[model samples]
Target: MHLQVRIDIQRRRQFIQIATFGVLLIVHQHHTGQADPDDHRLRVFYPRRPKAHRITEHMDRHLIVVSDVIEPEVEHVLSAGLSAFNDQMTGINDRQSLAVTVRNPDTHQVLGGITGRTSLGLLFLDLFYLPESLRGSGLGSRLLNAYEEEGRRRGCRSAVLYTLSFQAPQFYEKHGWQRFGEVPCDPPGTSRVFMSKAL
Candidate 1:
């Protein structure tokens, strides 16, 4: 009879232990579920993009508009200063700085501006800035062709430039430039796309 009582106690203790474990598991699951009602953290997908050879793009020319704060000032200043400095080095102080300005043929008002440069025997069609309304017009194409002609005259073998992933990659591709490398941007998930074409 004592043996039977001890067996009963042991079975009862096992049952209590199992029940306690089940209750704890239920409470843990309930708390976890309550903490995140909308489970958005569990879903992510990474797609593979084409990889290409890495190239450190070197730029030698630029354009600047100091008065226009709405524009990219530092880029303009850097480009202008570099061009001026390079010209001074070559003993050619003439206004070789090419700033392509488009005007409305009817109103005679300036539409936009584009800048070009020659670096290390290569003409670089670096900076092209046009207002929104002027886009889709043939002005960009005209400016590019003119810039290439200038580059040819300057004896540059190639032209290179960079654009952000959010910007006009398709446009550059359409214009016979090929993508070479991309640098991932920090703090934001973006990339700088570099492209070049033989002149």
Candidate 2:
């Protein structure tokens, strides 16, 4: 009976530790939106409380996965898990969002723009789009330059992006981006071009 009581205590402590850490992670992420990064490992942090801890033993537990829908709570679970693991590994957290919006001159409705981020001294260009009306008017270059300039201001030393072969690879090259890698993608003869530039 004593041994059983001890085991119960240990299990309860484990559950409390896990639950407390999970809550801390969620609160941190909620306050500061972050994603996984290598330059800056996908990480999140909360106010100082304790040294980092780890769960070493693997547990066998039944699990159920629900799919085919977006759940904010589900996303928090994923984000917290990843951020915790990455934080444990790197002991560093430095990820930031960087985006530029293009809006209609007349109505001010958003047309398109660049979306990316800076982490660990590197700028990541995630998406860039300009409608047909704005493609060739030198605005694309301005936007690209703006994103890069802000990245530089944020201490990023380089920039990276991927573009489809049919999707303005030349436009990027014209802005001095170099193709470092390529992978065949959908649409015959087309490929995803990975490009990078030194800031």
Candidate 3:
């Protein structure tokens, strides 16, 4: 009985030592921002929640605007989120941007052009612009045709774009792009018209 009691005491001391060590290790990890591999609760209790909150607040307070400032780190984070979402939805996320530029041969100044991307069998025409001087000279048609050809070469089956009602909705229509929908803008007689064309 004495031997058993001594063994019980030793067992209780060992358990207390283990518990104390575990607590110390957890506290050390928490202080150092190092996660304990065996403890999933450490991540939850230590940095993940607070880090997530910080990220949420940072994102909430910031607005992404069209500007000259280039933030590569912020862009990478946003692009990663989009890529992950695209991957989850389609099981494939391949986005390749194509730019067609018209430049003066003598001065090498870029006048205007088209910029777009082909992803998941669809071409997204993000930007298309031409100078007023070059508008009626068939350059726009040539650029549009060249962009669509490149999209087809990249395995895109259809193309999509949006033009303001006051902008080149008629130009797209002239090029066989059919209007799919439109959203009215703030000012009267203006709307964002969505158009699509099959390759």
lDDT of 3 by residue, 22-87 (tens): 232111113334634343332223333222122222233352233345579878998999899999
Candidate 2 Cα errors over 4 Å, as ranges: 1-59, 64-66
- What's the lDDT for residue 158 in model 3? 97
- Per-candidate TM-score against the hidden true structure: 0.49, 0.64, 0.63
RMSD of 1: 20.7
- lDDT (10s digit) by residue, model 1, range 1-199: 1111111122112111112223211001112334333332221112211122111232232222123243476679987998788788897643345566788889988877668767566666557878898788787788777787787787777888898888887887988889999999954888999999888
| Models ranked on TM-score | 2, 3, 1
Candidate 2 structure quality by residue, lDDT tens digits, 43-150: 233332222232223334322433456579888999889878877888867778988989988999999999998877899999999899888899999999999999
Each prediction's Cα RMSD? 20.7, 15.3, 14.6
Report the poorest 10 consecutive residues by lDDT, candidate 1.
1-10
Best by lDDT: 3
Report clashes for each candidate as comma-separated counts.
Answer: 1, 2, 0
Q: TM-score: which is higher, 1 or 2? A: 2
Q: Which stretches of candidate 1 lie over 4 Å from their true place?
A: 1-96, 106-108
